[model samples]
Target: MAMAVPAQTIAGYDRFPWDAILLQTNSALMNNTDPNVWASQIISTLRSTAVTLPSVDLAHRLVSHLFWNHHSPIAWKLLDIAASLNLLPPLLLVALLSTRIVPMRKVYPQAYRLYLELVKQYVLMLQFRNNSPNYEMIMESIDNVLQLSQVYSHKVCEPGVALVEFVFSILWQLLEAILDDEGLLDHVPENKPRWLSRSHDMDIAEHDCINEMKTEQKEGMQRKNTMIAIEIIVQLLQNKMTSRLLCLVHRNMPSYWGSFNHQMQLIASKSSILKNLKHITADTLLSLMENIHGVVSCNTKSKLESNVVIPAGSQIAFGGQCEGSSWSSIWLPIDLILEDALDGGHVAALSAIEIITGMNV
Candidate 1:
């Protein structure tokens, strides 16, 4: 199970001001103190078994000094050293960097890209354990990442396509991690017959009980994962991010859409949030279709080749009803586009006019 190291409070110094230490560190750097010296000392103290680490808030303030003073080479060196020693908390780093990304982006494009890469690496290192007991921390970390993506997407543009793509990739990983836990429950061994287990029946019985408890825990986790998945999907829709994300996928990852949609559908079905699933899904598809129409119309008016690439398998067909839920009428235009794409080699403009006309009708 992946778990964050809890912050440790120092005895007799519970109210120690971290700002003073940061100021001292900065003063030391100005006096030409080797960054390795001060950086190593701080990191060592944090890792020491005998000493206590500061509270979470103070810890963040101390570590964030490096990010806030990123103009100094000393700060970057310290961050590199901390990351090397696995002492840097991924969530804290993400929060700090993401909040300041707008200015960093404008002032230092190269540093912005490098720090964003580091952030991506840190996020990938985070994984939710099966039946982890640290629910609050894990959920907070997830929420932080979601908010980080929103900030990055909204504030950073121009050289921001890579950042956008990274957001989608991490979101997919988070969803997949949840799905993997659900997959584990399906393979749990059935109980052995009591008659056939006489010799080791006591141990067997205890094992069975443990397994039963684990199964129940996993079921509860599944419910929570479902709600999280719904939140992710809804945010993507509300921000209109999925359409651009699909274009990125189409250009570089043609095969992912199939499984991505399946994951979305499975997650939706598992939660009460699915009550408006059809409406939400329709709105998402309609937005994408409308964007496609506009792109095609522009290209046609200019008699230029279109730059749009439709996501492979974006044209999925649905019945009048799926399970008990009725398909929304808004899906009709999207369905026509899907049918034409399946037959016409996934061409972006092939049925765009017809679909738009159908929508108007």
Candidate 2:
């Protein structure tokens, strides 16, 4: 408000005072004597005081000083600036993954784009993750992704969902493995599976993939290690567990606009992923079908995981209530694949996954 008060005045606020500068420069605004003007006055004083400093941490100070106390659209504008400056915490990570953002969404003409902004944030996280920086950056990025996933679960677009699943799945897998090795499984997430420790547990009998080794040789060792990673994922997705979770979430979703939480739930299942054979189907699936209103168009399980990339042609379109009437269900070579019900939720979720994974396959 005070001519975007410069940083130099910040350090010297109490001396020459930016408030005086504002009183002189913005005499009209100062005349009102509104209490809201206090922030402006203080900032002006800060500018005059800080006029000598070479640079300033305006963004960091903004949140601590102003936005924390009085959040508003204007305050968010400062945050947007900080986000551009790599200052603000990633807020809409799930949004970016959905291909629902500005530039990326603009590229995909026909695919459903809902939460691209969140997914963009996710892409940043992945890039940072793959860059293999310090533990803090990786952890921060994963935290942001998980946070976005939870925050935007109901808002996810089906087409963008697989991408989200892929990114979060990989991160979760890595985190689980790390925690397990460190004896911190209970400290992290409890559902992780297929470790050397729990072979006889019947509660997860179906998720025996991680513990089984084809051989102990070098090649077998590599294969077995990757399998272990996938197994951890499967446990998270146990017993039609992912699909069941998706069904529960789809109920509250606003019909077609929602994300693929259901499909993510399905993807979380390891048996459904590795074996590609339906070992078990829930009886309550009928109720799940009723709720989704879309048929279990296909029940084929997937066999891909973190290292095993989703094949180039694996992605398929999902048509929900919009099926038959408006949206035509077509099979395209999408980078993402949905193993859930042929509904809106899964389709959107795949798009998000694509964005985060940055995988064309």
Q: Per-residue lDDT tens digits of candidate 1, residues 1-361?
A: 2223445555654443353346546765577565567666665444433222222343356445654442444454444444434344444455445444322332333334344444434433332111334333333443443453243333422112323334455555434433443452232232321111122211211112224345655455345444444444455433322433334333333334444455555544442444445555534533443342232223222322344343322121122321112222321122222222233222232222222221100
Against the true structure, what is each candidate's TM-score?
0.34, 0.22
State the C-alpha lDDT per candidate. 0.38, 0.32
Poorly placed runs, candidate 2 (over 4 Å):
1-68, 87-263, 266-361
How does candidate 1 score on lDDT?
0.38
Clash counts for all predictions? 0, 71
lDDT of 2: 0.32
lDDT of 2 by residue, 1-361 (tens): 1123344533444635433543432442234233234444444455544332111233224433431133222333333333332322232222222212111211221111222223233332232211122223323343343343343342423323333343444334333443333344443222533222221211222222223423343334333333343433333233232333333224323332132223223333322223332532332222333444232223322323234444443233343332212333543223233333223322133333223322111
